[model samples]
Target chain A: MASGNKTTLLFYPSTTNVSAKIHPVVLFNICDSFVRRPDQAERVIGTLLGSVSADGIVEIKNSYAVPHNESADQVALDIDYHHTMYLSHQKVNPKEVIVGWYSTGSGVSGGSQLIHEFYSREVSNPVHLTVDTGFTNGEASLKCYVSFNLSLGDRQLAAQFQEIPLDLRMIEAERVGFDILKTTVVDKLPNDLEGMEATMKRLLALIDDVYNYVDGVVEGRLIPDNNIGRFISNTLSSLPKISPATFDKVFNDRIQDNYALVYLSSLARTQLSIAEKLNTAAQVL
Target chain B: MANTMARSFLQAVATEEVAPPLRVVQMEGLAVLKIIKHCKEFSPALVTGQLLGLDVGSVLEITNCFPFPTREEDDENEADGANYQLEMMRCLREVNVDNNTVGWYQSTLLGSYQTVELIETFMNYQENIRRCVCIIYDPSRSNQGVLALKALKLTESFMDLYRHNSFIGEKLREKKLSWVDIFEEIPIKVSNSALISAFMTELEPDSPVVQCDLDRLKLSTAPFMERNLEFLIECMDDLSSEQNKFQYYYRNLSRQQAQQQTWLQKRRTENIARKAAGEEPLPEEDPSNPIFKPIPEPSRLDSYLITNQVANYCNQINGAAGQSFSKLYLMKALQDN
Candidate 1:
C-alpha cells in the first residue's frame, strides 16, 4: 500500500508468439496468504481474470518475484507452492487459474469503459484494479493498484500501473464529470450503465463550458454577446444529434446501435468549443 | 228606489186577480218615472204603496229591513208558494225593465237557511231561463259575503248528503243507517252522472270495461312475479343448469319464430307466383329443420388445466427466491456437463 513500493504491473505485447496473442498479461506474486480466506483466494486467483482458450491452456512465459528478503533465493518456488496448494484445494489446474485471471481482467476492462464514460465529467482520474498477480502475505506481493498522472511542479508524469489500465484510469477521471450531469438528467432518459455514462459525459462537458463562459463574463474578460453566441451556437449544433429526429429514435429502437457513440462525440465537440472560449476568456481576464 | 219599485210591482201582481198573465213593460219608460218620483225620500212611500192599492210612481224607496225567509219556512207556506213565485217573477221583471236601473236587498238574517230559500225560489221561477243569473256583488262588504257564502255551501252540501242518504235507503234496505252514513260521508261526489256509470262498469264482471281493467292490473303485476320468481329460480339452479335452460328456451323460441316467418314468406311467394301464372296456389307445410342444441358443459379436465396453469405460475414466482448466482451458474455448468 506504500506509494514508493507500488510498482506499475505492465502487460504489453511481448516478443514471443504465444505472449503476443495475449492482449493482457497478469502477474501475481504469490506467497504465504494471510488476509484472504481460502474461498476468496480461489475466486480471485483460480478463475481466469482475462482471456483463456476453451481447451483451458494458459501460457505464462516469464514471472519475476521481487522478494523483500534478499536471502530468499527460492521466492518464486515458495510462491508457486502456495499457489498450487490454493488451486489444488479448489480442484482447478494452474493453467485454468491463469486463464480465469486473464478472462476476468478482460471483463473488468470492458466494464471500466462504461464506468469511464459515466464518471468522465467530474473525475480527475478513473483507476481500475487489474490483478497483476495472486495475493501473497509478504509486503512485496503483487496486489491491486490504481494509475494516476503525477504532476511534479512543471512536469507531468504519465505513468501506467500493472494493476490499473490507462484506459480505466482515464475513465475514472471522466467519471467525476459524469457524476455532475447524472444529478441533472436522472429521469429524462434510459440510464443503462453505459447509456447513462455517455449522457453524463455530454452534459457535464456542456455545463463546464457554460460555467467557464459565465465566469469570463462576470470577470469582464469577454464581451457578453460573444460569450452568449459561442454558448448558443455550440448548444444548437449539439442539439440535433441528441434530438428525436436523429440519434434518439435509432437509440430507442436498438440501444446497442452506434448512434449513441456518434451523438456523444458531437456533444463533446460542441462542449469543447464552448469550454475553450470560456478558458480563453478566463485566462485573459 | 229600484227595490221599492220591485216591491210595489210584486204587490200589484199579487192583487191583480189575473191568472198569471204574460206581461211586458218597457224598462226605459219605467226608469224615467222612477227618477222623477224618488227625487225625495221614498221609504214610507214604498211601504204605503204596497199596503194600499196605489199605482205608485215607478220609483219607490225601501229600507234594508225586509225579512229573509228560510227554505223550510217557504215549504210550510206551500199553499202560498205559487203566489210567492208570481211575486218574485214580477219583481225580477221590474228590475229587468232597465239595464241601468240598480236594485238592492239586504238583511242581517242572510244565514244559510235563508240563502237556500232564495236559491230554491230563484231556481223555481227562472230554471228555464239561462240568462237568469244571481250575483252577490258586494265588493265593500266582502268578509260578510264570504262567510255567508261558505255557510251556504255547507248547508247545500248537507242537503246533498240527506238526498244521497234517502237514495241509499231504498237500495240498501236493512243495512240502513250505516250504509247511508257511509255514502253521505264520501268526500267526492258524482258531479257528472256519465262518469259515475263508466267507473261502475269496470266493477261489473260481464262488462268489457272489467276485462280492460283486469288486463291493466295483470300487466302491472306480472313483471313483479316474473322478476322475483326468476331470481329465486336462478339462485337455486346451478350455473350449468341455468345456462343450459336459458340457451334451450332461447333456441326454441328463435326456432319457432323462424319457422313461422319462413312459412309466411313461402306462402306469400306461392301466392304471388299463382297470381302471375293465373292459377291457385298449393297449401304449404311448415319447414322442418333440426333445432339448435345448447353447447355442452365444460369438462372437469379443462378446469383442472386452468387451475394448474395458475398454480404453476405461482410456483415459478415462489421458486425464484432460492436460486443465487452460484447456484444458477452451478446449474448452468451442470447442464453443460
Candidate 2:
C-alpha cells in the first residue's frame, strides 16, 4: 500500500472471463458518546476524507448521526437512539463485512442490529431484509451484493423499484408513496400535471356550485324570478347553437362545458319528467 | 218705508188672485233662459245642438245636465249668434221649469212623463248630483231655466262662503278649548242663538232679512257660516301666488299654533302623570317655550291686495253678478238665439 492522498486496489476473480471494476464504499461510523461531545463528533467526521480509496470512485455512502448520550441499559432507550442505514443491493456474492466501527468504551461491550435489503432491479416486489443481531461488541456486519451486470445509466431501474398499484391492496399502499414521489418527481415528470391539477381544482369548485344549486332547488330557495330568467339566458348564451335533435346530443353539445349548467339542466329535466308522470298518474287516479 | 211697501206688495201678490198671467209668463221666460245658460256652462255641446238644430243623443242629454263632467265633451258649440230663443224656451219648459205659462204653452212640451224619464236618465248617466242639476237648468233651455239656475248658483256660492265663515268660527272657539272639550260642547251650543249671532256679526254686517222670512236659511246655514268664511279665506289665501309674503306669514302662524297646542297637551299630560307619581311639576314659562315662539304678524294690506286680486279674477270668470249661472247661462242663451 502506497501512503498518499489516493489509494488503489486490484481484485482478480477466480473466474477469468468476469472482469469488473469495484468502487469502494465509504462508511462513517460514530461512537455512542461522540455526538454528545460536539468536539469528538467533529473530529470523527472531519477525519473521514483521508480514508477514501485511491480510485476516488465512491460507489455508495452511508452515515448515521445518532445522539450518543442515549441509555444502553433500557431496550426502549437503546432503540430510540439507534440510527438506521438502508442499502439496496441487486447482485454479487453476499458476505459479512466489518464496514466500519467507533469505540463506545475502552473494550467492546455494546452490540447493535444489522439489516440488509436485496432485490432484482427488473421486477417490483417486496424487498428482502436480512437482519443479524447479538453482537457483544460495538460493531455490526452488513452484506451488500452489487450486481456486476448493473448498468450505471439505468436510472429507470430505480423508478421501476417504486411501489406500483398491482391489486387493490397495492393501490392503497401506493397512495402515500406516490404522493411523496409526485413532489420529488416534479422536475423529472412531464409538464401536463400542473394544468391537470388546476383543472381538477376548478372542476371541484364547479361541482360544489352544482351541489349548492341542487340543494337550493330542493329547499325551495331558488324561485322563478328575474335572476332565474337571466341566469338561464346567460347560460344559454355561453353555449354554441345546437340544431334541433334528441336530448343526448343537445346536452352533450351545449351543456358539457359547464358542469353546473349541465347539472341544473339535468335536474330540471328530471323534475319535468316527474311532473309529467304525476300528471298522468293524477289523470288516472 | 220702501222696504215696508215692498213687503206689503209681496204679501198682496201672494194673497190676492190678481190675474198677472203675462207677468208670470215673462218671469217664466226669464227662468228658462237662466236654466239654459246654467246648463250650457257645464256642456257646450247642448248649446251646439240647440244652435245647429242637430239631433241629440243620450250622451249629450246627460252632459247637458252636468255642471262638470269627468272630461270635457267634444263638438262644443261655437256659433253664439243663432236664433234659438224660442227653441230654448221650449227646451226649458220641456225639461226644467213649468210648461203651461204663455211663454212656454205653445212650446213643444217634451211631456211631463218624458221629461221625468229624461231627467232620470240624465241623473243615471251624469252620476254627479251638483253637476247634473246645474246642466239640467242650462239657460239655453229657456228664461225659466235661466232664473232657476241663477237662484241655484247664488245659493251654492252663499253656501260656500258660509262654510268658510263657520270654519273660522269653530277655529276661534277652539282657541281657548281643548279639542275634546270643543267637540263635546259643539253639539250642545251649536244651535245657541248668541253664538250664531256672534258668528254672523263677525262674518257679515247685513245680519238679518226681516222682510223676507229667511229663518230656515239662517238656522240651516248658521253652523256652516263661519266654516264657509274660513274656506273662502283659505281659497283666497291659496289662490294668491307663492310670492305673496302674507300667505307665508298666515301659513307659518297656523303651523306654529298647531305645534303650540300639541306641546301644551303633551305638557299637561306629563304634569298630570308627574303629580300622580308625586314628582315636582315643571314651571310654566309660555314665551320661553320653543313651541310658543310668537309668529310674525302678517301684512294685512298685502293680504287685502292679494285677496282683492283673487276676487277680481273669480268675478271675471264668474261674470258681472259673480253668480255661477251668469257666464254659462248668458253664453248658452246668446248661442241658442
Best by TM-score: 1
lDDT of 2 by residue, B1-337 (tens): 9999999999997765543211000111112222332233333333212111111221111111101111233344213212223333343332222222111111111101112233233334234322222212222222111111211011222233323443232232333221111111000000112221222222221322211111111112222223333443454555344235644766787888788778888888999999999999875557777767776543222222233333322322222112222223332332333
lDDT for each residue of candidate 2 in A37-114, tens digit (9 for 90 to 100):
343322111011111234322112222222333234421211222211111010001221212222232222222111
RMSD of each: 56.0, 53.1
lDDT by residue for model 1 (A36-136), tens: 21333221222122333343222322121111111222111134333433333122112222321221122233233333332233233322333322213
Error of 1 at B232 (Å): 43
lDDT, candidate 1, B78-182, per-residue tens: 555444434433432221211121222222211111223443533442334311212121111111111111101112233344344432222323322221122
* TM-score for candidate 2, residues paired by index: 0.14
Instruction: Please identify model 2 stretches exceeding 4 Å from their true place.
Output: A1-285, B1-27, B30-42, B45-283, B293-337
lDDT of 1 at B162: 39
